[model samples]
Every structure is written in structure tokens, then in C-alpha cells.
Target chain A: MTRPTRPQSAPAEAATSATPVLELRGIRKSFGSNVVLDGIDLAVQAGEVVVLVGPSGCGKSTLLRCAIGLEQIDGGEVLLDGSVVSGAQRDQQARTRMGMVFQSYDLFPNMTVLDNVTLAPTLVRNADKAQAEERARALLARVGLAEKADAWPNTLSGGQQQRVAICRALAMDPEVLLLDEVTAALDPEMVHEVLQVVLELADEGLTMLIVTHEMSFARAIADRVVMLDGGVVVEEGGPDFFEHPQTERARAFLRTFEFHRVGR
Target chain B: MGAEFLFQGATIQRLLAGLGVTLRISLISVALSVPLGVVMGVLFTRKNRVLRAVLRVYLDFIRVMPQLVLLFLVFFGSASSLGLNFSGEVASIIVFTAWGAAELGDLVRAALEAIPQSQYDGAFALGLTSKQTFARVILPQALRSLLPPSVNLVTRIIKTTSLCMLIGVVEVVRVGQQIIDFNRFDYPMGALWTYATLALLYFVICWPLSLLSRWLEKRSSR
Candidate 1:
């Protein structure tokens, strides 16, 4: 399913040949009269973790959903690994290349944790039952929930359920993973464990797009950070976006989040 | 006292024969109605405005018209008007099927609509097409909701079978009437017992259905 993905400009291509596995250009979405995303442009290289941080209702989740083809975008294009991933069509095939973990831990409550993880693999990928189960077991083990495989999703704690959600996404072997507030619903102490699993996945070369409230975790793990306010990108930078913010908006936004004092 | 004797004499034979007809009509009508109703429900829920308007009119007509009136329309009025010579039993089946199908269709639509919109989106995100999602995910969940109402409908069908006697079908109530007619002098109280026993039999059948509805409700809630 690989395509010839040659970037246009020599310098831009050289910088990008980490070559972005996912790109969104001039993406715009609106609900009737209210526009949520206006001319947004972003890209993620292979194995990079890009965290989208924003205040509530700033349309961070909407952007992630648009990229994953869960919600249709009213304008512009989404490319997954140099292939068009959005439009009136392209839903199922595009979704197969990416996986999403919803904030509510949308694990199928009627299914066991193993079945939840294995569903996309067996159903979407057409893997046999044995292969799906095996993959589910290995991924569950990675998430530290191997023993929780046969348990119902409702029986697991929020943290464990979120981990299972991650395992479910991994089973798809997606080229890019979209995580929309995977730990927002978790108990504060439990958030670290789930974030650690995501950090580990990023380390292991998974291309990830995450929307999160945990600023410190984002600073530590993300290769890039994109700040959104009023449904538009306010800033995009590396770790220094947190250290030496570029704009007053970025500084004010960063200060609202209580980061632990490193030293005076 | 003599009524008790008549019941001991040949009441058992007649009641059994009547029971056979009751079971036969109820089972057949339910068999035809449940599936037909589910399909109708689905059709009515479609996005097409013209089709939706037609279904609304049909359902409203069915809901307002009494079953006895519909039965007469189908068995007497429509059959005769159309020059058909259908047997009383066949006519009874036709009337009940139409009645049950309409009611069942409404229940099916309610059940299907009750499924959360998220479930459909969930399946779509998994790459399942609309048909696959409906069959594998939506239908199973909808069927669970459809169960209690379906059982309730079946019980209703059983009770409604009594109305077939009015159209000259030899079902339980008609057989009871026959028993009373044959032994009026020998047993003054025989009619009371025969009618009472028929009520008792219907109660026996329907009480379990009521229990089943409760059970299914509990299961779905979990």
C-alpha cells in the first residue's frame, strides 16, 4: 500500500523525508454557521509524536476526528502516507491505515477485553481467529493487562480500560494512531500509567497524534506541540514552546497549566 | 353440580380440540408477524420522506381501527368484496397476521431506534459497511430490545385468538359455546365453568409471557 511520496521543495523535502506519514492541508470544518477549523495545516513524520494542546471546545478533537476520517471535513484534504484519506468517500480504506482511541474508552462493553482488542484486527484485517487472539494477547501484555484479557471492559478500572483501548488500536498495526484524550477520564494518579504506555509506544516508533491536557507529559514525550485556541493553531514548536514560549497567548496558555517547579 | 358432571363427561375432549386450534393459530400468526413487523419497522425508519409518510398513514390507520373491525374487514368485507371463498380458519389467520404485523412493526422500529448513535459510528469506524453493521451489530442489539415486546405481542395474539370465534372459527371459546349449547339442561352451571376454564387456560399461557417480558427487561438493563 506504499506510494511514491516525493515532497516538492528540496529543502522542505529533506526536512520532511523523515517524510510525514500524515498531512492535513488547508483543512476546514463547519457546523452550519459556526466554523470549528479554518485553514488548518499540520503534518506528522514517521515515528513522531505530535501533541495537540488546547482549551476545551477549541476543536482539538474535531481535528483528530477529521484526520482519522471519523468526521467528514467540509474543506481541504487529508493524506495518510501520501494517499488521500478524506473526502465524500475513502472512509473505510483510510480508517484501516489509522486507529483511534476515544476519550470515553469506547471499548465494546458487550465484548471481553481481548475481543475488544481483536475486533478490528479480525474483522477489518480479515485475520483468522487464532492470529487475532495471539496479537491481542501480546499487545495486552505490553500494556500490562495480559491477565485482564477475558475480562469485560466494564469490569476493568478506567486506567486498565484506557490501556486496553491503546492495545486495541495497536492490534490494527496502524501507520498512524490518533489518540483523543485517552486519559482525560482517568483518575489523576492513574493518568501517568496510561501516559507511560503511550510514551513507550512513541519510543517504539509509532506515529501518534495525541490531544492531551497533561502539559508536562507532552513536553517530555512529544517531538512537536501544536497549540490551538478558538479553533486555530496559535503556535507550533518543539520543547522550547513550553520553555521559552513565542507569543503572549502561548505563555498565558502554558501558565494556566500548573507544571511542577523544576527550580527557581 | 350437574355442570361439574358434564365437564367430567366430555368437556375434556372438546377443550383439548379447542386448545389445538388456539395453539395452531397463535403460532402461525406470530411466525408470520414477527419478521414482517421487523422489516416494516426498518422500512418506516428509512430517510425517504414519501415512504415515511405512507408508513405513518398505514400505522395510524392500523392503530385507530379496532382489531375486531379489521378482522371483519379482512374476513367478511374484503374477502367477499374480492370474490374469495376463504375458510374461517384461513380468514382468522389472515386477519390476525395483519393485525400482529402492524403492531410488531412499531415495536421493531422503537427497538432499533433505541440503539445509541455511537454504536453505529463505532462500527463504521471499524470499516464495516452499512449492511454489515446493521446485520452484525445493530440487529443483534435491536433484537435484544425487541424481545420483551415480541413476547408481549405473542401473548396478545393468544388472547386475541378468542375473537376468531366471532367469525365462526372453532377455537377454544367457540368449543366452549358448543359444550354449553349441548348440555344446557343437564348442567345449568356448565357454561360458567366452560367459560371460566377457557379464561384460566388463557391466563396460564399469558402469565408466563408476562414473566418472560420482565426477565428480558432485566437482562437488557444489565
Candidate 2:
């Protein structure tokens, strides 16, 4: 099976000089007797977009959660700009540097869209309310949601909610954005709108680590693609890795998506 | 003659005074219980096993024992055994506040638990502190689900204040009984009229609360 050729960013070769913006070194995590991640290492450089792709339950989402300090790792360490930000050292202040978006948009239902976006900036950064709202409005306008400033979250469509969620995370001015299946909960028609917002963010050179099942999207946006199976990295490469996966597990995983890609 | 006795100016004043006492106990208990119940409810959601266990015992004890028994224990037993003298009205207040707080605490716990975990995750992801998350995010949403049932609790407390009569507190029911005994010889149907007035008074107070609860339930569900 062959994938359609598309414009792709050059690999993150330019970022090898300084410490990575986000790094997970020999990380291990388990729930009860079940080991979800085992000694995995990954790095996302400043302005790099890394997409983690694997079969369900392969720890892709868990790894993203660990990077943002939402989940405590059982072994190894997570680092942000060469400083440790995991385990006992993980604090709310350190976590603000990394933004995360969940599968469920999870917008605070009680607040309006503008409030949702400005909450972290005003509360955590101590930014002026006017400054925070101005930035939030600009972010919302960028996503074509400026009119929804006073709208409650439940009043918006799934795609619009996800877009507002992206704005909320971006408003924090995070050093690295961690997206855990952000498009997973949207309807088929809605997924494109949400993904389009993300694609634009990629073009603006936001550093991101995304876990997604959208192979075509992964190929289009990822500077690096890391394939995982059974909690370990099986193959890591550039966009062309989809056509030339170096491992049997990665090959098999990519093959499963071919059935969906046949007529397209 | 029975109707005339029931509507006498002095008898009407006595009934009003008795109702005032009932409202004072019920409203005071509710005011104290709602806030204390909210704190206990939040504690119930925490992961502290010892704290949870202790609260659980308090909640369960209140649930299993009757409020009348609690009133008696406080009013009768405290004066003799604990050597702490409390008036009947004071005893009734203490017992009802304890009962209301426990019942309302359970209601609050259910409301808090009904909120999805994703709400907390969303708040924490934005770097809001735990206290901020509770005050700003969790409490506002919980209050929506909490209001209807809480209004229902208010009505229950108001009705149950009638039980204070058993503890020698002259609430509305006690006032009605006194009127009946005094007019027994002069008015043949005085007992019936006085009891009917007492029932009407309770219905007037509680009916509006039930309506408010239902209205709130409808709004929150939306």
C-alpha cells in the first residue's frame, strides 16, 4: 500500500544543539500488575512536532500524560528544558509550562468560552484581566470562534469546544503542548475542523507531542514519528517511515490502517 | 363554639408564638447544617482513610438512630449523666442540627461524586490549585445538583420540628394540644378544629418548599 505524497516539515535536525524542550528518559509506569510503559525514551525539541502512533493500549496516551506530570512514573524521569519535572519534584508551577488537551474537551461547563481560555493565564500567570481577555479573544478569533466569547461550553458543537480547548491550553503559553487523542471524541464531520486548527498551530511552529490514530495527519504534521507496541518504541523515523517502517511490529501496525485507507 | 374558640385572639397569638419557635429551631438548624454539611461532604470525597472512616461512623450513627431518640438523649440524658443543663429548646436545636448536618452531608457527597473526574483533570491541567479547583470549578457545578435536594431537606427539617413537642418544647403541635385541653368542656369539637389548624400551618410552610425543590430539580436537569 502506498500513501499519497504531501508536504512535510524537514526532520528536527536543526534542534539537536540545545537540550530538548520535553524529554522522557527510561520512563516506566504500571497500574497494579499491568505494566503500561517500560523504559521508554523520547524527546521533542523546541518547535518540533512529534506524533506517537501505536495500537490502542500501547501506552501512547499514558506516555503523554506522564510527560505533563498527570501520571506519576514508576521509574526514570521526565525533563523540561533539561530540568527534572517528575515524581516528587513535580509542582503546579512546573506543570504550567506544559499544556495538555484531553480526548474529552473537558471545558469548565460553568464558565463561558472566554473565561475558559483566560482562566489559567489570569489565575496562574497573574496576568492582568484585560491582557488575558485580549489574548484569549485573539486566540478565539484565530480559530473563528470570536463570537463565542460569552457562550457556555455546552452550547458549542464538539468541534468548536475542542477548538476553544486548544485556545485555553495555548493561552497558558506552554513550552510544550501535549495532545492526547484530541480528535478521538469528535464525530467524523467535526474531526476535520478540530484537526485543521491543530494543523495551523503546527505551521506557526508550536512545539507539540501528539498521540493520534490519524495516520494521514501524523504523516502531514509530524517532524518525527515514533511507533510503539507493548510499551516500547519499535521504530522512530521521519514522515517516510510510514512507507519504510524498520520493524515488523511497526509494519503490522501500519498495515491495520490500510483497510481504512483502501478507497481513499 | 369550637370555631370561635379556635379563632379567639389569645388563642391565635399563642399559636403564632408556637410557630415562631418552630421556625427558629428549623431555620437555625438548617443554617448551621448546610455549611457544616458542605465541609463534611468535601471531606467525604478525600482519600484520607482515617478521616473518611470517622465521618462514615458519624453519618451511619445518625442514620440508624431516630431523631426522637437523639432529642431525648440530648434533652434528658445530658442533664443527668453529662451534668450539662440544657433547656428543651436548646436540646432540640442540638439534636436537629446534628441530624440535618449528617443527612445533608450525604446528599452533598452524592452531588460531588456525581461530577465527572474529567472536570478535576481539566482544572488541574490548567495549573489551578486543589483549593481553587474546589471553590471555582467543583463547587459551582455541584451546587446546581445540590440545590434541589437541599431545598427538600429544608422542608423535612421544618416538618420534623413538630417532634420537639415530645421533648417538652412548646412548638406548634404542643400549642394545639394545650388549646384543645383548655376548651374541651366549653367547646365539644375544639380538639378537631385545633388539630386541623396545626395541619394547615405545616402544609402552608412545607408546600412552597416542595414546589421550590421541584422547580430547582427541573432547572438543574436542563
Candidate 3:
């Protein structure tokens, strides 16, 4: 079920062999008159964690959704590996290469935590149930939810559920994971555990495209940070982007998220 | 109207015969309609404008028309005018199915919708096709919320089947009327006793449904 992936660019193929695991070129999405994403371009390279930071309603979540094929993009193209995968027809199987965790924990309320993690592999990949369960238990134990495997999602604390959400996405064995504000709903006290799990993933070389309001976490984890404003990429750079923003738009955006104290 | 009259061997036999007919129609319609309603419910959740509009009209049509009017329309009006051949029992079954389907569809839709948007987004983000998302994520949650209301609807459908007496279907109420008609002079209060007995029978059937509904409500909430 794995198809050969095409190469993205000359340099990417030549020296680095660092083709973007997921790429979006001029992706555009509009909800009728309200254009959520207006011609955005971004890419997450292999083993890179690219955090998208912006004010609420700047379309960070929409861009993430469009990339995952949850929401259709009306303009531009999305590339998984190097193949075009945008518009009405998307390569659904290729999407398994990149997993996403939502702002809401979004764990299936009916299923046990273990079932939620193992679901996609068994159902979509047609993996053997025992194998999926074994992997699920290992992943759950990593998130400190091994005891909560058979527990309902609602029974777990917000932090545990959010960790389970990460585990669920990881169960797909995705090359690049998309995380859209996975900790936004957690209580302030509970946010650190979720971020800690993400930090560990980044350290382990899992490529990720993340949209988050946690500027400090973004600053620490992001290999590159892209600042979005009103459906457009206003600025992007290294870890220093938060402290020494290049654009007036980026500086203005970061001003509002004053909680981030990076590269002082 | 003494308690002794209710247990008379002859009265017991007639009521049992009527109960059999009532159950036959109710069971058939409930069995057919619940599955049909589930399909309609899933269809109702689709984003297609045409599907939504068509379903809205059907649900409204079924809900707004009185069962008696619908029965007459199907049996007396449409059956002969359209060259359809069916007995009163078939007509009753058709009518109750329509009623049950409409009610059950709305309940199923509501139950499905009650599932948080997060579950849907989670499924979509995982790149699950619509079918896998529903079967894996949405259905179990919907089923939990679906049962209580569905049981209540079945109870109402069973009760509503009594309307079939007007069309001469020989269900429980019709049998009660027959008992009253034949014993009108000799039994004095025969009509009163017969009607009360029929009501008691309905109560016996429906009260359990109410209890089941309450039980499900508690379980789901917990």
C-alpha cells in the first residue's frame, strides 16, 4: 500500500535529500465570503518542527485543516512528499503519512483510550488487531497513560486525553505530524504536560506542523516559526523570530502574545 | 365493570386475540421502521442541499398529517384510486411505518448531532473517509443517545396503532368496540368496561416502555 514518492526540488534531491514531508503552495480556502486562508505557502521539512503562531482567527487552524484534507482548498496546491494532493480529489492514503492532533482532545468518547489509539491502524491500514493493541499500549505507556488504556476518554483528565490524542496520531507512524493548538483547551496548569510530550517528539526527529498560542513552547521547540496574520504569512525565521521579528506585521502580532520571552 | 369481568374466560380469549393482532402490527412496523429511520437519519446529516431539502419535506409531511388522515389517504383514497391491492392490516402497517420512520429519523439525527464536533474533526484529520468516520467514531455515541427516544417512539407507535380500528383493522380497540356493540343492552355498562379494559392493556404495554426510556436516559447521562 506504499507508493513511490516523487522528489520535490533540485537541491532537496541532490545534497540534503531533505524534501519537505508536507508542503502547501499558495493554499486558499474561503467559507463563502469569509476567506479563512488567503493564498498561504509553507512547508515542513523532514524532522523539522514548524510552529505557526498568530492571533485568533488568523487562519492558522484553517491552513492546518486544508493541508490534512479535512477542509478543501480552493486555490493553490498541497503536496505530500512531492506529489500534488490538493483540490476536490485528494490522495487519502498519502494523508496517513502526516497525522494531526486538534485543539480539542477529540478522542472518541465511546472508545477506550487504547481503542482510540489503535483505531486508524486496524481500520484503515488493516493491521492485525493484536499488533495494533501492542503498539497502542507501548505508546500509551510513553504518555503515562498505560493504566488508562481501557478507560473511557471522558474519564481521563484533560492532560491525559490530550496526551492520548498525541498517541493516537503517533499510532499512524506518520512522518510529519500536524498539531493544531492541541493544548489550547487544557487548563493552564495542565498545558505543560502536553507541551512536554510535543518537545519529546521534536527531540526524536518527528517532523511537525504546529499551530499554537503557546508562544514560549513554540519558541523553544520550533526549528522555524511562521507568523501568520489575516490569512497570510507575515513573517518567518529561526527561533529568534519571536524576539527580533523582521516585519512590522510580525512584531505587531507578537506584541499581543507578550507571554513569549525568547532570545532576550 | 367489576374486576371479575376482566378475567372471564371468554373475555380473556377475545382480548388475547386482539392483543395478538396489535402486537403483530406493532412488531412488524417497529422492526421495519427502525432500520429505515436509521438510514434516513444518516442521510439527514449529509451536507448535500438537495438531500436535506427532500428529507425535510418528507419528515414534515409525515409529522404534520394526522395518523387517521394518513390512514384514510392510504387505504380509502390512494389504494383504490391507484389500483393498489392490500388489506386493512397492510394499510395499518404502512401508516405506522411512516409515522415511526419520521419520529425515529428526527431522534436519530438529534442523537448523531449531539456528538461533539471534535469527534468529527478528529476523524477527518486522520484522513478517514466519511464511512469509516461514522462507523468508527460517530455511530457508537449516536446509538447511546438513540435508544431512549427510540423506545419512547415505539411505545407511541404501538399506541397509535389503535387508530387502525377506524379503518376496520380488527386490532385491540376494534375488538373492544365489537364487545361493546354486541353486549350493548344486556351488559348495561359493557362499553365502559370494554374501553377501560382496553386502556389497561395499553397501559401495561406502554408503562414498560416509559421505564426503559427512563433507564436509558439515566445510563447515558452517567
DockQ of each: 0.36, 0.80, 0.63
Q: Write the per-residue lDDT of candidate 1 for residues B75-157, one digit (tens) a residue.
A: 78867799887777888788778778889999888988887776766666666668867876788778877888889889988
Overall lDDT per candidate, in order of appearance:
0.82, 0.90, 0.85
Model 3: how far residue B60 lies from native, Å:
2.3
Candidate 2, residue B10: Cα displacement in angstroms equals 2.0
- What lDDT would candidate 2 get against the real structure? 0.90
Q: Residues B1-222, candidate 2: write the lDDT tens digits.
A: 448987776999999899999999999999999889998998998899999999999999998998899998999899989999999899998988999999889989999999999898888888988888888889999999999989998998899889999989999899999999998899999888898899999989999999999998998777
Q: Where does candidate 2 chain A have its weakest 10-residue lDDT segment? A: A1-10
Q: Taking the tens digit of each residue's C-alpha lDDT, what string does model 3 give over A1-264? A: 111122321222332555677889999889989988889988777767788998889899889888888887889998878888775876668777778998888888888899999999998899999999999999999988889999989888899999999999999999789999988899998999889888877777778899998888888887788888888898988778977999988888777755666786
- Cα displacement (Å) at residue A10, model 2: 4.5
Query: What does candidate 1's lDDT look like per residue over A29-142, in tens digits?
Result: 998988999978999887677889978888999998888777789999998877776868775767778878888777776678998888777777789999899989999999
- Model 3 chain A — which ten-residue stretch has the worst lDDT? A1-10
Query: For model 3, how does the per-residue alpha-carbon lDDT over B100-149 read when each residue is reduced to its tens digit?
Result: 98888888889888888878888876768878998878998899889988
- Measured by lDDT, the strongest candidate is 2
Task: Give the per-residue lDDT of model 2 (tens digit) for A1-264.
Answer: 122332444445556677889989999999999999999999888878899999999999999888877788999999999989896657889889999999999999888999999998888889999999999999999999999999999989999999999999999989999999999999999988888888888888788999999888888888889988898998999888988998888888889887665577
- Model 2 RMSD in Å is 2.8
In what order do the candidates fall by lDDT, top score first?
2, 3, 1
| Descending-DockQ candidate ranking | 2, 3, 1
lDDT score, candidate 1, position A223: 73
Instruction: Estimate how well candidate 1 is docked, as a DockQ score.
Output: 0.36
Q: lDDT: which is higher, 2 or 3?
A: 2
Q: Model 1: residues >4 Å from true position, as ranges?
A: A1-15, A258-264, B1-10
